[model samples]
Target: MRNSRNSKSNKSKSTVMFILVLLIVGALAYTGAFGINNIFGYRVKSFEQAINKGLDLQGGISVLEELQAENIDNETIERTKELLSMRINPEGVKEISITREGSNRIRIEIPGEFDAKKVLETIGKTGKLEFKGPDGKVILTGKDIKNAKAYLDEMSKPTISLDLNQEGTGKFAEGTQKFLGKEIGIYMDGDLLTNPTVQSVITNGKATITGSSSLEEANRKANIIKSGALPVTLEAVEFKTVGATLGANALPLSMKAGAMGIGLVLLFMLIYYRGPGIMASIALVFYVVIVLLAFSVTGVTLTLSGIAGFLLTVGMAVDANVLIFERIKEEMKIGKTIKNATETGFNRALSSILDSNITTIIAGIVLYSLGSGSVKGFALTLMIGIVLSIFTALTVTKFLLKLGTEMGLLSDASHFGVKRG
Candidate 1:
C-alpha cells in the first residue's frame, strides 16, 4: 500500500517537473537565446547592449562638469542632468553620468576619448537658435523651434533644418514676409550660428540654415540649437576627465573577488548541510539567473558598488536556504516524517525570512535617500536584489525542494542531512 502511494506521488511530481522545464525552455526561446536567432539568425542587440558602457570597463575619458544655477533644488538638479546628457552625447561618448552633489554643485562624468575644446563648446555653449527674415529681422527664436537635423546642400555644404511648433509657424510667416531679401541671423547665446540670406518666405514654420563648409560644424550647430532651446538653461559646474584604462584594472579584480566569495560559500554549504547543501547550491544558480533577468529588464546600471551589493544579497540568499534546512533537521530529530518536516520547516522559516528581507529593503531605501553618487548605486542594487531573492527563494526553491522529496532523492531524513541515532 505504501509503495503504491509513493508511486502516485512520484508520478504527480514528475508531471510538475516537466511543466517547469517547458516553461523555462519557452522563456529562453522567446528571448531568442536558444531558438531560431541563436541557430540561424543574428540576434538583435537588447537595450542592455546599448547601455552606456562605463568608462572603467570599455576605456574612455571621464569628464566632470560643474554647472551654475540660480536654485539648486531637485528640479534644477534633474534638468541639469538632462542638459549634460544632451551635451555630452554628441562627442561620440560611450557613457555619460551627471549628478548633483552639494546644494549648488553638479558633477559630470563622460566616458571615452574626447577633445578638450570640443567638449567645452558642447557644454559651455548656451544655445539660442533663431531664424531671421531677409530684412535682417528676427522671425523665430530657439524657443520657437522644436528640433533640428543636419543635411547636405547642393554644394555638399552642411545645413541644419529646423522644425517649429504652431505658435512659431504663425509668427514666422509674418516675419518672413516682412524681411524678404534680407539676411536671417542664427545665434547661440548671442553668438552667430549662421547669417544666411533669406531666399524665400517660409510660412510653414520650417526653415533651413545653410552654408556650413563641413559636416562636423553643421552637426555641432544642430546640437547647440537643441541644447539652447531647452526650457531651462545649464551651467557646467565641475568636469572630470578619466582615462579609459581605469576599468581594465578594476574589472578583473572584481571578478576574482566574486569567484573567491562564491567558492567559499559553496564549500561552507557542503560542509555544513551535506546532501541538502548540494541541492541549495543548484537552486542558487537559478537565483542568479532570475536576478540577472530582473536587472536587464529593469534598466539597472551595474556599477562597481552595485556589484558588491549583489554579492551580499547572494550570501543572504544562501542564508535563507540554510535556515530552512536547519529547521528541517530539527524536525527530523524529533521523529517527524520527512514530508511533514520539509513542509513544516519551510513554514516555520517563512516569518524569519520575510522579516529579515523586509528590514534590509527598508534600510536600502533609507541609504538611497541619504546617499549620493556610488552610495545610491549600491542601495539601488541592494533593493532590487532583495526583492528578486524573495521570489526565487519562496517559489523556485520551494518547488525544487518538493520535487526532490517526491522523486525519492530526499525520501528519508538521513538523505536530507538529519543525523540518525
Candidate 2:
C-alpha cells in the first residue's frame, strides 16, 4: 500500500513538472527569442530587433575609396584607414566596417544607413593638420609630426604624446620659445581643435598634448592629428547602397525554413526515441532560447550566412542527443537498469560529443580570424551555436533526463528504444 502510494505521489509530481516545463518553454519560444506584440499594450521585441544586422541583412551603403597620392606608403594608408574608421564609427554602435583592399583602396560597409552621399561628405575631406601661433602664422603641418599616440602619464592623466621629425624638431623648438607664454592653436581642417598655452620650450622633438576628458577622447584626438597628415586625397572610386527590400524578403524565408527544419527534427526524435525523445525536444527548445539570448546580449551582428550557421548547429544539437540515446540503449541491452544506463551512457558519449564539437569550433575560429564580411558572420554564429549546443546537450539535457528518471517517467528499456531480453 505504501509502495503504491509512493508511485501515485511520483506520477502527480511528474505531471506538475511536465506542465511547468512546457509553460516555460512555450513562453520563451513565443515571447523571448521569437518575441510577441501588443498583448497588454507592450511590445516584446525580437532578438533581431535588439541585435545589429549586417549590411547584407539590413541593407546599407558600400564605398570603395582609393588614396590619390604619389608614392603611397603603408604608414599613410594605415593611418588614413584608422582616421576614417574613427570618424565614421565614432560611437562604435553601428556595424560600420573599414577594411583595406589591395594597397591603396579601402572598402567601407555601413549597415542600416542608406545615404551614401552623407557618408561620403563625412569621409571625403582631407582634413589638413595645422599648428598656428598667436600671431596666426603657420608653425607646423601634419607631415612635421613623426608619431602620435595616447598614453596615461605618471599622474594617470590621459595625454597625447607627439613625436616630431628632425626638421619639425628644430621648427617646434623655435616656435615654443617664441610662444612660450602665449596660446598656440592646433587646427584640423581649419577647425580649431585646441589652443594650449605653451608651458615650456624644449628642443627634444617630443611634446605632450594634454586636457582630454577621457582616454578614448585622447585617442580620438591623436587619430585626428595623424589623419590630417593624410597626404592623399580620398577619392570615392565607387559608392552603392544595398537594397533593404531584398534583405527583408530573404530573412523571412530563411526563418521559415529554419523553423520547419527544427519542427521536423522534434517530430523525428519523438517518433523514434519515445521518452528520451520528449526530453531531447524540450532541451532543444531551451538551447534555441539560450543561443538567441547570447546573440542579443553579445551584440553579434547577424547576416544571412549567420542564420545558416545557427541552423547547422541545431543539427549538431540533435546529433548529441542521438549519441547519448544510442549509448543508453547499448548499456540497457546488457541488462543495466535505466538509471545506471543513463549515467554510463552520458559518461561514455561525452568524449565523442566533445571531440566533434571541439573540432567544429576550431574550424569556426579559423574562419572568423581569416574570413571577412559574410564569412565572418557565419563563423561567429557557428562557434556560438556549437558552444551552446555542448552546454544544452551535457548540462540541460542531462538535467532533464535525470529529472524524468526521478519522476519514474524514464524507467524502462523500451522507453529508451531498447527491447528487453
Candidate 3:
C-alpha cells in the first residue's frame, strides 16, 4: 500500500510539472505571435516593435559637427552636447547616438532618419533666442528666461508658457506697458517663432505664446526654449547617410550566422548527453524566449555586436547544463538513485555557476558604463542574457530533469552520458 501511495504522489508531481511547462511555452508563443494592437485588451509593444535596431542595422544619417568657438573647454563641449541632443532627440528617439569625437567636435548618429540636410538644419544652428518689442529692439534674451513648458490652454489649444528671471520680469513689464496694443516678437536664431500682440503688463514674470499648429510643435519649441542657446556655434563638418539596402543585406547574414551557431550547439548537446541533453535544449528554448521578451520590454537596441554577445551567452547557458549533467552522471556511477544524483548534482554545480556568472555580470556592467555605441549595446544584451541563463539553468532545467527522473524516463547512467561501475 505504501509503495502504491508513493507512485501516486510521484505521478501527481509529474503532472504538475508538465502543466507548468505547457503554460510557459504557451505564454512564449502568445507573446511572439501577437502584435501590439491586441494582447488580451492591454496595449503593449510587440516583439518587433520593442527591439530597436541600431544605426548599423538600419541606415540613417550621421553628422559630424565642430564647435566654432576658440579655446573651448571640455565643460563647454559637454554642455553643447547636452543641448544638441535635446534638440535632435527631444522625445527620446531610439538608437540615436551623440558623442564628443574630439576636443572641439561632436558626432551625432540618428538611425532611421533619411533626411541629412533637415537634421543638419535642426542641430547645427546656435538657437539663440530673443524677445523683441514692436520697434525690433531686443527686450530679453534666453539667458533671462527661467523656465518654459508646453501645455494646453483652457480652450484646449497647445501653447508654450514662459517664466522670466527677475531682471527679465522688469524689462518685460516695461516693454509690455509701452507696447500695449502692439506686438512682441519671439525669435530664435534670427527666425521669428511668434509675434503676439501685447494685451497687458506681465509684471509676474509669466507669459504664454499661442498659435502652435500642433502639440508636438508646441512641445518642441518649449524644449528648445528651456534648453537655452548652445554656448558655442556648431558647423556641420561631415555628413553621411547610409543606404537602407546595405543595412538590409547585413541583417539577414547576421541572422543566418546566429541560426547556424545555435543549430550546431543544439545538435551537439542532443548527441552527447541523450535524454538530459534533450531536456537542456528545451530549457534553452525557454532561456531564449525570456531573453527576447526582456529585450522587447526594455527597448534594448540590438546591433550586430549585440547579437554576437547574445550568442556567446547561449553557449554559457549550455555550459552550465553540461556541468550539472556531468556531476549527475558521476553520482549515478557511484550507485546513487536518479533522484539523489539529480539533487546532488545541482547542489555541487551551484557555486561554480554563481561565481562565473557573477564575474561576467560585473564585466558587462563595467563595459556598459565605460563603452560607447555598439559596445554598450553588446554589454547590455550580454548582461541580460547572463541573468536569464542562470534562471533557466537553475529552475527550468532542474525542474525538467527532476520530472524526467520521477517519470522513470532518465534513470540510467547511460542516459546522462556515463557508464555504471
TM-score of each: 0.73, 0.82, 0.82
Candidate 2: tens digits of C-alpha lDDT, residues 86-130: 678754457787777777888899988987778987787667789
Please give the TM-score that candidate 1 achieves against the real structure: 0.73
**Each candidate: RMSD:** 7.1, 4.2, 3.9
Model 1, span 153-175: residue lDDT tens: 88777889888889988987787
List candidate 2 segments past 4 Å from native.
1-31, 34-45, 66-80, 101-105, 144-173, 200-222, 231-237
Model 3 global lDDT (CA atoms, 0 to 1): 0.85
| Most accurate candidate by lDDT | 2
How do these models rank on TM-score, best leading?
3, 2, 1
CA lDDT, candidate 1, residue 413 = 75
Better of 1 and 3 by lDDT: 3
Clashes of each: 26, 0, 0
lDDT of 1 at 334: 95
